[model samples]
Target: MFKRCFLTLVALSVFATVPASANGAVFDMGEQMIEISPIDGSDYYTGSANAQAQVQNTGGIQRTSFKQAIDSLEAAEVEIREEYAVYTQKYNEAKGRYDVAKAECKALKNNIKQINNRLKNVEKTKKMIFNNMPG
Candidate 1:
């Protein structure tokens, strides 16, 4: 079970270390909203509401923050796809390497699909947020 725990930690580290920064820039959300999270190495959003509600609360910074989240999601999608490709190729090449065990490969494919679905949801959220914003 050490292997399982180790793999879980590795997987979390792989994705969590990637900050969702927009063009390597940080957002000035506020002191209360910008705490650094020890678990993910990201700015921990302290608000009780969802991203849209939080955006609404931020008022003037809504558009930029929404765009930043969208960009971060897109970056994550790309990174997930890159990792998926490597595993897919390995799976195709030998069908076994211990590193790309059959079950692990299947899990990776599922993760890739999940990331794609997440991107779609993010796009939909962006549209909804944009439409609701006051002109």
Candidate 2:
């Protein structure tokens, strides 16, 4: 009995140490609307946008604040892709990574007020798109 108890305890400890995928709520799929302003002297007074969404979480270890940072990065990536697509009319793999980094920098560049506002509004924006999704 004592041996069995020890083994069970050890097993439980191992399981406890193993990190589980995040159980906190996440959007299955959602859309984001972004507004892109034109660069001066650009051919078109171009404004473009893309659908942004979150399909997965990187686990719960990161705080909501940090995850928001990541989400902004992902959204920025999508934006960059849309821009590249518009300009070149061709796809390049590196554009995606550039967009992501741009967004991460944008989000991280701000102090608390701006960051908080951006993070807070993300869910609302996501839900708005989610609700509008086709049946």
Candidate 3:
């Protein structure tokens, strides 16, 4: 009788320690949501559908499936690609303008150099003419 009572007590204690429900509670933390489920040492998923429904009903917490997440990422990638293309076009246009401006500046510098050389030649000719004149 004592052995049977001790065995029953141990069995009750073990069962009592186990949680009654495997589905956990979800906590809404303002921007994020967290779900804590009791690990029942089983690979079976019992609450995935319910969790998905809850996620859909709740607008703030976005728990998406793998496919949905991938689709969203792909959409974002396409948008980024379009933006990159636009920026690349703008950069090419700016580069072309810069090249044109740089060429103009180089031409201006060459013209200034030529003018200085001509001025030096004129000064030399004037000195020669003055030396030939009397007094």
> Highest TM-score, which number?
3
Clashing pairs in 2: 32-52
lDDT for model 3: 0.82
- The C-alpha local distance difference test score for the whole of candidate 1 amounts to 0.82
TM-score of 2: 0.21
Ranking by TM-score: 3, 1, 2
TM-scores, each model vs. reference: 0.28, 0.21, 0.51
Off by over 4 Å in 3: 1-64
Model 1 spans > 4 angstroms off: 1-58, 96-135
Deviation (Å) of 58 in candidate 1:
4.5
Local accuracy of candidate 2 as per-residue lDDT tens digits, 1-135: 999999999999878766343322222222223455667875765676777887787567568779899999999999998997777744344688789988888778776668788888998899999999998
Q: What digit string (tens of lDDT, one per residue) describes model 1 on residues 1-135?
A: 999999999998877766654324445555447787658746777768645633345655888899999999999999999999999898777855664787898999999999999999999999999999999
lDDT of 2 at 76: 100
Q: What is the lDDT of candidate 2?
A: 0.75
In model 2, the runs with Cα more than 4 Å from the true position are 1-62, 90-135
**Whole-model Cα lDDT of every candidate shown, in order:** 0.82, 0.75, 0.82
